[model samples]
Target: MYGGVAAVKELSLIVCRGEFLTILGPSGSGKTTALMLLAGFISPTNGDILVGGKSVASVPSYRRDQGIVFQSYALFPHLSVRRNLEFPLEMRGVKAAERADRVANLLARVHLDNFGDRMPSQLSGGQQQRVALARALIADPPVLLLDEPLGALDRNLREQMQSEIKTLHKEFGITTVCVTHDQEEALTLSDRIIVMRGGAIEQIDTPEGLYDRPKSLFVANFLGEANLLNGVIPLPNDATPTSMLSIIRPERIRLAVPHAPTLADAHQRQQANGVVTEVIYAGALRKYNVQVGNNVLIMREHVASDQQVFRPGDQVRLDWLRSDVRLVATETNNGVE
Candidate 1:
């Protein structure tokens, strides 16, 4: 707790061996605080942290058997790339010859063998990030901690590094815990994602599961675009309780002219009519905001050569498979371990 307010409360999770787990949330959602707690940077007021079945909650950061890659890269500016990678091994009392060999192997592994003599400032942002990752892995620690590791790069570079990180994770098979607010990053890299809000876990599931079946309204909207069907439309089936709300993805909606011929599978689809209120032309997809009754429902479709495009004021019909709808709680629950 900080300043008498609980920064993270009743948070409990297990990081399986060789699993890539991501803690995802917006600012002040307690994700970073949780990472700090795991890294031994701060001791929890009540609770224990177990690594390899041993309690290490009170251990200092330096003594923990884990590697961390901070957002800043945190390379020593005065040292060469090779020396930076060697620092951890040196501190662990590795012999000079073994340290040199390990540094060389890691440099080559990160595609920086020829640049080992260069300083951190002399390298580009991507290259420096690679070096930081290499340094983190040089000691072969059992767990790896990443704190917004890709926040420093541009869009294209970040994509490239994401692939790189995924490949490295596959190769090393290390148990990794990453904390970030980027939904795309979490979805792309994690085997499982923990969505946190208001200092509590909103949900924990695989990326596909979380996006497809969020447990609460906050998670449904936060992870991706969700069209709340509550008060906007009637459910095709009445299986859901009144306390829950139905939601559908924007891409699950299909749009057509109001008088278009009925689809072949109309028997299994639910249909609605609305006037197009807005049309947004994204490069690869079309986004439409259609006003049905008093609600504006969003619909997305890939831009295809033979597809009909609707504009504002156009009458459109939206349809989706009856099974595409999902039910979620209207509010988040006070989570437990």
Candidate 2:
């Protein structure tokens, strides 16, 4: 127990060999604490932490042999880039010449070949992150722990580093555990994501499964833009429906010119009438806020230069395949997760 409060409960999942597992949750969700427990920085109150099928519950952080990269770069400000990378090898008693070779190879691998002589203060945020990653991998540990590794970087650099981290994981084939509050980052980088709330496992699935088939309202709303229409809605091929809140993705919604000719191929499925309330121009997609009765729904369409753009005050019809509608927990859902 953490301060007599359960910081994590019913948390169970295996980080497969060479798989990237991300623990995703909002603040105070115990994601960071879980990572620390896995890394031997903190011990679980009652539970076995197995590494390679052996319990390491009493092992200290330094003895775990797990590479860790903190949110802060954690590089020694007084050291040059090369020295920071060499420190791990030195601690392991590697000879100077061998450490030099490994450091050089890692520098080249992280695209920091020319910045080896510079200090951490001299490098850009992205560069420092790369150095931190290279250091984590320098010893070639079988398991890696990353605690909000990209939380410090800006948007553009965050994306760039994300690609780099994925490449590194693929090249090294290490079992990795990442803790992050960024949903997009988890979706983009994880092989399997574990969504945590109130220190418990809400759902654990691949990025696609979590987004397309979330069973809870909290997960449905947390992962992406979700429209929860109240009461019964169309279910699959059958017109007979069940009573529950209907969850539909914004992209699943299709908007068409009202009273226009219904195309024979598509857009003839389940339909509804609404007036455009707002149009948002997001670089690659146009998000339309539509009002149906007293409900306002969000519909996202791909932005095309040649397509007609619907504006506010325009009457539009929203259509979707019955298969796209997913029922939220009718009885099991009690408020949020």
Candidate 3:
């Protein structure tokens, strides 16, 4: 709690060994506070943290055996890459000869073999990031903590670093806990994701599970693009309960020419017709906003050579298998209803 306000409330989780778990949410969602609590940087007012079957809640950040990578790439600006890598080993009383060997191998592993003599200021943003990651793993800690690790990089660079982090995680087999607001990053790198909302856990599931079958309306909209189907279209009698909300992903809805002939599986599909209100052309995919009744439903389709493109004001038919529609819980009184 910070100044009598609970940043995380009734939070309980278990991170499996060698698992890559990511805490994902928007600003003020307590994701970072949760990471800090795990890192021993902050104390939990009413709970204990156990690492490897022992209590570590009272352990200081420096005393806990863990690796941390900060968003700023907190490298020592005055030291050369080699010296920076050696600092941790030196503090741990490792011999000079062994430190040199370990530093040499790690520099090569991060693909900075020839640049070890350069200072932190001399390297590019990506290079600095690599150095930070290498330093964190140098001690070979059992746990790795990442706080918004990729937020400082550009789009292309962020994607590249994502692959690098994934590869290193596989090779090291270290249990990792990462915090980020980027849904794509969480989905791409996590074995499982925890969606946090208002200082509590909204949902915890595999990336595919969270995206395909969110447990709440907030999760459905947070993980990816969702089309809320409540009062917008007629649903089957048993499809959704009064306490649940119906939603479908944009990509799950198929677009066809207006008045198109019904398909063989028509009995299993729900169809609707609407005018195309907007058309978005992303390089590899086309997105359409169709006005059906009083709601604007979004649909996405891959751009193909033979695919017909729709324009604004064009009449279009949308259809999806009834099974594709998901029923999620609704929020009430600032909690799931």
Report, for all candidates in order, the number of backbone clashes.
0, 0, 0
How do the residues 5-34 of candidate 3 rate in per-residue lDDT, one tens digit apiece?
899988999999999999999999899999
lDDT of 2 by residue, 78-166 (tens): 99999999999999999999999999999999999999999999999999999999999999998999999999999999999999999
Q: Model 1 over residues 151-262: C-alpha lDDT tens digits?
A: 9999999999999999999999999999999999999999999999878888999999999989987888889899977766675475455668888999999998988998
Number of the predicted model whose lDDT against the real structure is largest = 3
- Off by more than 4 A, model 2: 231-243, 265-268, 330-337
Worst 10 residues of 1 by lDDT: 233-242
Lowest lDDT block of 10, candidate 2: 231-240
RMSD of each: 1.9, 2.3, 1.5
Q: What is the lDDT of residue 278 in candidate 1?
A: 94
lDDT of each: 0.92, 0.87, 0.93
TM-score order, best first, reads 3, 1, 2
Clashing pairs in 3: none
Which runs of model 1 end up more than 4 angstroms from their true locations? 236-242, 335-337
